[model samples]
Target: MTKGKIKVSSDNIFPIIKKFLYSDHEIFLRELVSNAIDASKKLQSLETMGKFKGEIGDLTIVVELDKDAKTLTIKDRGVGMDEQEVERYINDIALSGAEEFVSKYKDKADTANLIGHFGLGFYSSFMVADNVEIVTKSHKKSAKAVKWTCDGSPNYTLVDNDRKERGTDIILHISDESKEFLEEFRIRELLVKYCKFLPVKIQFGTNEETVKDKDGNPVKDKDDKEKKITTPNIINNTSPAWKKQPSKLKDEDYKSFYRELYPMNFEEPLFQIHLNVDFPFNLTGILYFPKLKNKIEVQKDKIQLYANQVFVTDSVEGIVPEFLTLLHGVLDSPDIPLNISRSYLQSDARVKQISGHIT
Candidate 1:
């Protein structure tokens, strides 16, 4: 049994995170899931670079809610860490494994979809959980599996584990006050809001799907109704319309994506503008012009902002022009500067340029 204190300059870090790090406690899910997606992307990058000889199978991230145990687990089949790596990354505060991996393979791999920036994402789990356990097995051949446990304090425990998978499983023991996260509806809502357009697949639970026959037709029961089968409920569209080439997409494709973005809004858009710029700062998104009503304020704040496909905020006042706020759809850019919480944007010249480009 290896036990040690987490390296931090301040003893009040955990408390600060729980109380003030994020304005909304629900952001804990986004941060943790984003870390999981980063792990998966890291593995894909390694495979692209020929560094990982093993098969990269099933990169879907699964978010399981164990309400009986008051626990939520985010599992990913990605680049898991060894014992020493866990000690350095988990024990040491503010050292981002994703950032380090991207830096090391920036020239050798496709790391455009990696979403982790701040190293404090893992600590956000403490905001909603009383205790957290990370069971991980490295992707390296013959690597040993290990488990690290922390109880929302500076102290932590690391021990050998029997985990057979080559990935990470983050188990969060939901706190008494934050038991709402254990609810299926709340988790599904959060997954839709924040991770609906993430680059990797995210499964929250299972949904009923109509079983199909060999001829690609729905299988019917004796009563003539379609026979249903349970399948993993993947929340996000891994490849959203905006992520694809505009030339390859038609008018209907854009409209379909708009419906995906706003299922409640039934009105079709007047027109769509596909924005893809790469020179000053990387940006790709689609802006929709909806029919304006008497009140423009109601239409304002419909433009959603995303950083590397992770939804940041819908209030894109500074990033987009005031008039453009009436527009609907998404704006994703890895170059956009964001605060530690990723809830707000930091002022930058690129931001001003993006606003002007939108105008």
Candidate 2:
């Protein structure tokens, strides 16, 4: 057996990819959903260019599980990649190429954009999966479908495949060590924590469950009378409360949504500010000020910022004003770069301007 030429300059990137400064292992949800959202936006751009005349149906991303098979799939009806696109985007994830892409699009790209600022989202898959496959067909009708498979190493195979649809389906061969990714409850929690307000619809489970009785309560099944029947609570909210117009919404609606977001914290929010600025990309949001104990740490569970309604992170110290860290509740914005460090923000004036608006 012969080992082929190494693509990138660094063989040491895996350590950073698997376990870096990222304190939370759940960021994989944000990365994958962001990829889906990016694909959806690309499709929208194509529609405007008269590339795809087909009606742009609902841009919803779905996660399905095969517990018995120990598999997980993320399906997106967005701008899928053709064979060449797969080669360009999937097969080669060199950090140098990422830097080049940033340079090529820098002038026109939005500073707050979420195009793998850390250049590590794709690699995050290797953190959990032993094998990952990308089945994608570009939005272009004539583009050839490509199936890219990788085994958590430098090597990958990109071959032609058949897919009548115009999107991507990422099937993860769940590793025994990472079987938790296949759990509905775990994925649901991650989605609620990270993707509650994503611009695209993310359906995790069934739409309806019959276990709940007609009285809107869980009913004990005749066969299982000894146990109270459990009903499924659909976790992801495609159309988050922040996305709606504040004028059209009632005060109670915001409060209810807040409760849905932070159920553990029962205390009422001090005040809620709905942010619906549309000039610089589609950023819409609401910021709530939950009551904080004076003795608590200044950064104790601060505002959770969302990109395109997808929950980014609660440690939004640099994105929000320094003063705002004392507050709590949702801060959904598509522009806030979730992964970028404060050192980067200091150099970028636009990011600083966005931070100024946090107060």
Candidate 3:
């Protein structure tokens, strides 16, 4: 049943990866969505710094639903892909795409440069869908538009697609088994749960409302100028507490931001630590000590890690000390290698260095 090259390995790699690496399946969505956020963040940074003289439009990620087609699409108005990028980014499933993206834009963590670091993030769609397609056009007008198709296997097809914009639209054809992903409410809840403070705007659907006329009366007429409003729930916060300098941010600002992060969470953060260091490696974050009642179960992805203000991972053990897992808040460190493993960190000097730095 097994095909090709007899895939040599001492340990049962497949089972090991399935069980160990994928400790959390829902993490796939987190990874994929965060990658989109990263992409959007990069574009925003480029536009802000005047490096790329382009219209700085609404930086948002779109999640479209096609019930009939059984597909879910997460589109971003950020850096798109050209032919060469498509081939280099999608076709060859490299493990360090995220690393490359980060290295290229260390300061920008400013661009989605970190998202592609671990080619593994995009593949998260497979955890919820059967097939995934990436339709993109580079920010450069001269760049060629490209499309990539994959069906949950190593084999993938790269072709040219018709695209008019300089962004990416990733469509996931939902598998028969993963229909829960199609639920709008479920998707929204997930977005709010994991991507609340992500550094990009995220749009889900549209909404209709009555607008007041000059007479201050509700106008529901079909010809009314306030027709169909693009109902977009802002999914991310571009400038979060962790991104800015500690001196610039006030105590009230931190408390306000914390409430924004956790509304239902009643108890205030026991204490807050503002982390910002650029030397040995770029890192900036704010760790919050949310009240710990009775030996918390060691929440999986508590400390959200971001590169260049873009969400990279919630699993921050690599950069965050293990003891700090009990805390909650954002940890924006551009150093923690993409999907860095605990075992690898045990031997990695950077991890040790970072651990020593954390208070």
Give Cα-based local distance difference scores for all models: 0.90, 0.68, 0.69
Superposition error at 171 for model 3 (Å): 0.8
Q: Which model, 2 or 3, shows the larger lDDT? A: 3
lDDT of 1 by residue, 1-359 (tens): 99999865557776887789888889999999999999999888888888899989999999999999999999999999999999988888788888888898888888777888778888889888999999999999989999999998888899999999899999999999998999999999999999998989999889899889889999999999999989999998989998899999999999999999888999999999999999788999999989988876655568889999999998888888775677898899998888899998899898898888878
lDDT tens per residue, model 2, 1-359: 89898654435656666667355566666777777777776666557656569878978788888899777788899878887767766655543223444465556544234344454566667767888899988877688888889887677888888788889998888888888888988988787777766656777776544466678766666786533434344456667687788988998998998888777878889888887776654556677877767675676465765554555556665667666676666665545544442111232555676666655
What candidate 3 gets wrong by more than 4 Å, as runs, is 1-21, 41-56, 95-98, 101-113, 207-230, 269-271, 288-328, 337-348
Q: Which ten residues in a row have the lowest lDDT in candidate 2?
A: 338-347
Backbone clashes in model 1, listed as residue pairs:
none
lDDT of 3 by residue, 262-296 (tens): 67777788779988888797677787888777867
Candidate with best TM-score? 1
Regions more than 4 Å wrong, model 1: 1-10, 212-226, 294-298
Best by lDDT: 1
Q: Candidate 3: minimum summed lDDT over ten consecutive residues — where?
A: 338-347
**Candidates sorted by lDDT, descending order?**
1, 3, 2
